[model samples]
Target: MITPTITSLLNAKAFESLVQSRRSVRKFDRSVSVPEEAIHRSLQCALLSPNSSNMQLWHFTWVKSPEVRARMVPLCLGQNAAKTASHLVVFQTRIDLWRRHARWNLEQTPPSSGSESDKRRMQLMRKYYSVLMPLAYRTDPFGLNTLVRKLGSFLLGLTRPVMRLGGRGWQRVLLHKSCGLAAQTFMLAMQAEGYDTCPMEGFDAVRVKKLLGLPAGSEICMIVAVGKGTPAGVYGDRKRLPLEDVVSIV
Candidate 1:
């Protein structure tokens, strides 16, 4: 609510430079540190991300120490970008957070016979419980952890959504598109701040989660690093099939 009331919304053209400037920068000069405040600003932008129920389910871990970064680099498929970049962020989605937030919403009741503080507490409880219940229906978490896991694969179109290979469960693959959007938003923000960046999913999830001490029911969906790009930054070819190939009309 505190965000400014825009007299006009941003047109797609208004965001042209941001869209054009964003690139998966693979090389960086590692001598500098991304200002901690700028890192916070990048994460703060994600706070405004839209979620299934305003649960703000995304969490980010910033890796700043050299040894830790080296440990994580191998986990990320030996990508040196994770080491030398000024910022390395591991973005994750918390199904547990979603489930808990949802159940809390479903369990709320009217303010009981109590003081105003109790009444406020009850009101808050009701709000979250309401949000969570709907999400649970969409997620369908029954006692059938097996069934839920099985169904999650089907729903998410994964061979195994939570197989328990290492971290989290079997790990469904759908998060890249959703979480990738958040990472893209980060890259765009970084670019707008004159920072170059890269996102990597081509790594061992099991290893990276350990490096970050991620909680269970969470998975490292993507990694992003930011800094000034090398003069010979290896940018992939940018090509699109065409609007006719991808767009549709009602």
Candidate 2:
């Protein structure tokens, strides 16, 4: 593999700077509007974020119109970020669409000649999407599937290392994790594009889902506000514990 050149190292430093500079802005300058194209570009970058099993079970809802944006202010609990921001994006996780996404992953595998290695790879992909994913994602009202998964994990782990799979709650956690990463990517991309973003988790999920016309099974991970942030938007100086306190070499 090719090693990172000096140019690449410099680019890495630039990315570090970008990461360090980002703040959870609360107040945006209403006079400074964020362009639609910038939001689109940042979302494009967000689409490239790593996700579990490449299922990509997430949705980005950009609240664009003035009327809808007005409604969102109250839905977001009347936060200054929502009230003054130029763009609002709702991150949603669709755990109910697992089967469809698994099938989509299956269709992405190219047809290969029946060589041993090729056949093995193809079969592995098929089994993962068709069998394992169904086992992992399929839920029951009475928690029967959860019990089966726990039993299977216990039995498998008794002999060798095996994943401890749980029920719908675990699946939701995994999906939300990936969705949060996408949101982070989008926020950084916006920062790089000379805009600011605030990720708001304090909101009425029930009302937001209804307002967005989302299905009952869908979950709102977070709502991000975007705009040219004002000086007062930053609550205080950036603060973090010492690196040694937060991290340790193991």
Candidate 3:
């Protein structure tokens, strides 16, 4: 393992401050406009976040148009954060792109004529993206694929540990989990850039999807409102249960 240096320690402290400073700001200062460039940078940072199998099956829609943003207000339930924010970003999970992404991951492997280690790495990547991903993500209207996965796991685990996989529902949950991490990365990046964000999950998913013209297989993970925050934006002092009660030392 690499030794921790002064730079690493200072970076850790800075990150601790960033995490503490972040809040779910509800009331943005309408007078202060957040730059569009900052949003773009934060989104690029979000794309670098770790995801399942490196599939990167997520999309972000920046609601920049005045007419569209106005229409989104009602879809967001007229929350003050949505109304007063300079920008709104819609985080989405693109489950339909699984096949394409899996193929993309497979294609990223090194050539067959490379070194032995490289060859081994390439083979493992191929197996993961070509065989395992398809089995984990495929679905059917009658739950047949889910039953197959359940039985497969059960039979394989008769003598050893195995992962219990389901069908479409499990796939959806997995995609959302990755997409949510991307959303958190975006929010934290915004905070690091001296802006505030509110992640709102209380929107009408169907209407929001229609407004964005998203595909049926896509899911809206959350809508994040961004801008400079006001004093009233913070609801109260930060509060959490005691560490001993929330965490268990094993």
lDDT of 2 by residue, 25-118 (tens): 9999999999999999999999999999899989999999888999999999999999999999999999878989999999999997889999
Best by lDDT: 2
> Which has the higher TM-score value, candidate number 1 or candidate number 3?
3
What lDDT does the true structure give each of the candidates?
0.68, 0.94, 0.93
Query: Residue by residue across 5-30, what tens digits does model 1's lDDT show?
Result: 45334545557867886777788876
Measured over all alpha carbons after superposition, the RMSD of each candidate to the real structure, in angstroms, is: 7.8, 1.3, 1.3
Q: Give a tens-digit lDDT track for model 3, residues 42-71.
A: 999999998988998899999988789889
TM for every model, in the order presented, reads 0.70, 0.96, 0.96
Best by TM-score: 2
Q: Is candidate 1 or candidate 2 better by TM-score?
A: 2
